[model samples]
Target: MGDGATTTEAGPESAGVGAGLTRAHWWILLAAALGWMFDAMDQRLFILARSPAIRDLAAGADPSALPALAGWATALFIAGWATGGLVFGLIGDRYGRVRTMALTILMYSVFTGLSGLARSWPEFAAYRFLCGMGIGGEYAAGVALVAEAMPARFRPIALGMVQAASSIGAMLGSALSLLVGPQSRVGGWEGWRILFFFGVIPSVLLVLLRFRVPEPDRWLRARDEARRDPKPGRELGDVRAIFADPVLRRRSLIGMTLGMVGQIGLWSIGLYTPELVRDVVFREHRRELAVEADSLDDLARAWATETGGDADSKLSEWKAEADRHVGRGTLLQDVGSLLGAPFCTWIAIRFGRRKAFATAYAMSMASVWLVFGGMSRGVDALWMLPLLGFCTCGIFGVIVVYLPELYPTRLRTTGMGFCYNMARYLTAAAPVLLGRLAAGAGGYSRAAIIMSFIYVLGLAVVPFAHETRGEPLPD
Candidate 1:
């Protein structure tokens, strides 16, 4: 078997001294960051596009069916994402990070582009599920590729930089939706279709990637020549190896727990903020409508007794006024996401990953409390909703850097994929549980408090983890 130790001229010293960055390291960082940026953009675009598309598709249909469909689509997408991470993570370990990264990018980009062609909700959901498969694979491949390529001394920074790039993509998705959404000629469902079509631009990146990136020398050297020579197509047993060792087993378990907690908070609570905002807006609109209806009814009674004008016209005017308020609320939620993402990115880098993650979750819990509690009290605490988003989003950047350092190169992708993606299972179900709780309690405040307690659990876990700040990647 070929020992996994391919030597490269570019070693730890090439990462640059304390004062500056090296050119090669810069190139590696840029490549990974750019790839991750697009990956984030593609994943988020689906979420951003969902509301308008659902509204159009559910037009004249039972209102309850739309949220149900959205929930189903989200579950399917996460499943596909988990599958991609597991399958490609093994492939990355056996083959090469560079090759796997290129393949993953192409796979995701192509499917995301194909999503633009979907005509039915089922079709759109299927495309998104497929796109998610590729998108999920991208993280392990991209993180491993950059980590392996860069000097050990700079691994965290490189990975952190890549993680931060997700914010750029997310922000871009928000901007794209805002700009093209209203201006789209397709109207309703068609506008969403146009947005998906624009997703094709990332595929062009595949061609550039083919020429620019090279497979990491580390994986090439790690390849067991004896194994490869006799059976070139044979796959290595990374999963078996991960559990075969005692320390690795512990690390794997810890990593998975961390991932599950992180993802549940992120996917279930964090991603649904927009929906929550919409609900709040809807409730407010209903209140406004009721107030207007009562006023109009009183006016109509006076008019009937005096001038004898029509009641139906006054009712219609009140309905239009309520609709305007709902529309404005939706717009605010969308616009707020863009503003929130950058701040989140900045916080992750500035405050450190552990602190940043804890803070974000803390804020999210508080925000949910304010939303559910403050609403009944007639407090306009809507701003806390987006601030929670800003805090939660910062954790993505932290995870990118933190997860890679948790494993050695031999099992980096495998460990990361298992830890990061498998957690989606927990997250996938979190919203439903939260929804049920919200229904039972007649509000989301209790659920928010529950989520806050989970964050406290995370705080306890963080201290047990080894601090990797400025530390070299473990050998």
Candidate 2:
């Protein structure tokens, strides 16, 4: 192994007790978490609101075209997200992390709110894509801020906590859609407009960020060192510095692979659970509906009378039930986060980072297989849905904790941006794939089984990564 020396000189005060994180650390964590929470909330709201808005805009047009529009919008958003990660990751590395964080939050927030004003699908898609660029930048900046601020011993826990906070944001988004979505009167495209407006709430945090967060001391030191040295600034050499060594290269690769699989599985399995349930419900409803049909109106009237509810009421009731299902899934996901995050932190502290990752991956694989595979049939299978969420959430919660540990401070944001955002692009294809599989197989259970199998691939790669538990943050 290369002798890992501090890349920059530390102040005399920096040497003692590593100056165990003070109130400032907690304040930084709070600011980062809030920003991330809103970041996630806005992204998820777009997903939730998009379909309805597209359907409304396409009214008097072919219904089949809506899915295509959604796909196009999603593609545009992902492209923006990837671009943001690449551009802002460099910016964070070159500029101050605090400044970059502020810029990123403002960029995403303004566009996210602007998405509210979109009158057509093209306008909405454009706004969302712009908003995505901002959203994508937040992860790198926020992760860097929290990673740099916390004491090394507490970094894993801090990152885990921040990662878990996103779940809370996602759950809140779901709750808002359930609560405020139905009450909105903007029949065509207005429902989504209101939801987009709700995304503006996080922009308010920008004002507070100016007062609360500071530039990371590590970053400041690096800049000072760069200024003092004869080396030219804006050197392309720093880019190669990340991969010049074997250990760093290995860690970066491992981080990238883990991120790719984890992201694909998270979106494919986690976010799509509701769609899976809906497919099942629809199939069951269709079978029941097929039993009798006179005229379509007669069939509708008779079915409504027999069901003892109007279509809207029945839909509302189904929606309430779906909310309960999603609620359970969300709760389980949170519980997993609560358990796995601390556990991974503690394990990484005592055992090692690699072992901790392996253990988590093992549990994640088993949990996913059991929940998705085991639930392939029978009434008891329904219970597995929430259980799956619990297990996978724990797996995901381990990411923020572990990834930062793998890279030195200088390359941390770049490594993280590459791992996280690249995976997002790769995983973006999953929803379409899962939809195709569900369509071909005539059910979602098969699609879930396929998804669970991919987790095993992730498990196999765990052993290849270098162990970092109890190791000080690499220089």
Candidate 3:
């Protein structure tokens, strides 16, 4: 192994971080972090865009059926995400993380822009799935690059901060949605479509990644050795190798379980929060809108009966007003995310990774139920969403830092990608189930609470987790 790829060794984190990093080190961190930030922005944009885009694309469809339709689209997106994570991770391991990351940015940008032109639900879902490919690939490559590039003394800090930067990206997404709201438009384009178009702008960042960033010295060395001895191809993202080794296989199972809990909870829950808030606000605006109301058609009817106005125009106005508050709720979640990620990182640094995972999962489980069960007011979300965000998102800091520590340089991205994305195949079903449950007496809130139970599995898996604190990266 090269100096860049030291085997796990016990050591204390040093205060020499400022002295340890050079100009290039900072550049690597910033570049990887910003790419991840923009990726987060794309995720948030989809959350905000899903309902409106589905409404437009699924024209003449029953309003009550839109949630299930959107759920299916989201399922496709996660499916794409998992596939891309697996494939691009191999590419990163065999080729170069820098190039793979840059290529992913280009892929997502083009696809997301194309999503804006989707005229039907299937077209929109297809575009989102393709866009998810780019979005999903960026994580393993970015984390692997940063983990390899940084020295052990500051690797955790760098990884945690990189994960932390994503909250800022989420905030930017929320702010953009706030500015655009529901009724705004550009050249007759819906605000949701315009938001998808903004996905192209981040492709410019590819220049920095492509021109300035270099392959980690660790990966370069690994590639040289793999070329010399091509047998046992585990050195190049072989899926079987992760399963062939008993220790690695066990670690992979634990890691995959932990990753799935977060994936299922976050994707299913975040999908509906803004809409949940919109419903709450709309109901508050009109007393006649019942708690059991399952669709916007109820609001349309209420406006027509009570306000004696054009139902279509009134529905639009209500959505616009409620959307403003929804943006705030989303922003608060990001704010909590900003703080929680670092907090969990600090816990991992102090305690063990298992304990950190335990804390995050328990809190996440509680908050998920809180948000979905009787969290009916936007004002309540001011506090609830942040609590939810802190619990649900904080574990990412541990995830970003710890997964790379589990595998050697050659298999780092590949292992992390598999652990994180493979479980997404199971998670793809969660939204569909939630959608079905949502159409029942319990509605979105009840279904989301049911889905949140997946977090309990996170807690269950923690006992088997390997503690990686103060350990150097594996060779």
Predictions: Cα RMSD each: 6.1, 5.5, 2.4
Lowest summed lDDT window (length 10), candidate 1: 1-10
What is the per-residue lDDT of model 2 for residues 1-475, given as tens digits with 9 covering 90 to 100? Answer: 0211112223321134234656667778898888888887886677666656666665665543544555566666766776677678778877867777788888888888888787777887788778888877888888887877677656666777787677677767766766655224455546567778888788777777777667777766666666677364223215465667777677777777887776666666655554454344444444667745322234446668777768665655554554445444444444444455566655655666666666666666676666555442223334665455556655556677777767766667777777777777776676667656765664556776677667777878888876655456654
What TM-score does each of the candidates earn?
0.78, 0.82, 0.94
Tens digits of per-residue lDDT for model 3, 17-48: 54456666777888899988988888888888
Segments of candidate 1 deviating more than 4 angstroms: 1-22, 58-61, 182-189, 224-237, 291-360, 371-382, 435-452
- The alpha-carbon lDDT assigned to residue 72 of candidate 3 equals 95
Local distance difference test, per candidate?
0.62, 0.65, 0.82
| Reference-based lDDT, residue 417, model 2 | 78
Which candidate should be chosen as best, given lDDT against the real structure?
A: 3
The Cα error of candidate 2 at residue 218, in Å, is 0.7
Which should have the higher TM-score, number 2 or number 3?
3
State residue 387's C-alpha deviation in candidate 2, in Å.
2.4
> Please, what are the lDDT tens digits per residue for candidate 1 over residues 82-146?
87888889888877776677787888888887777766778877887788888778778888877
TM-score for candidate 3, please give it.
0.94
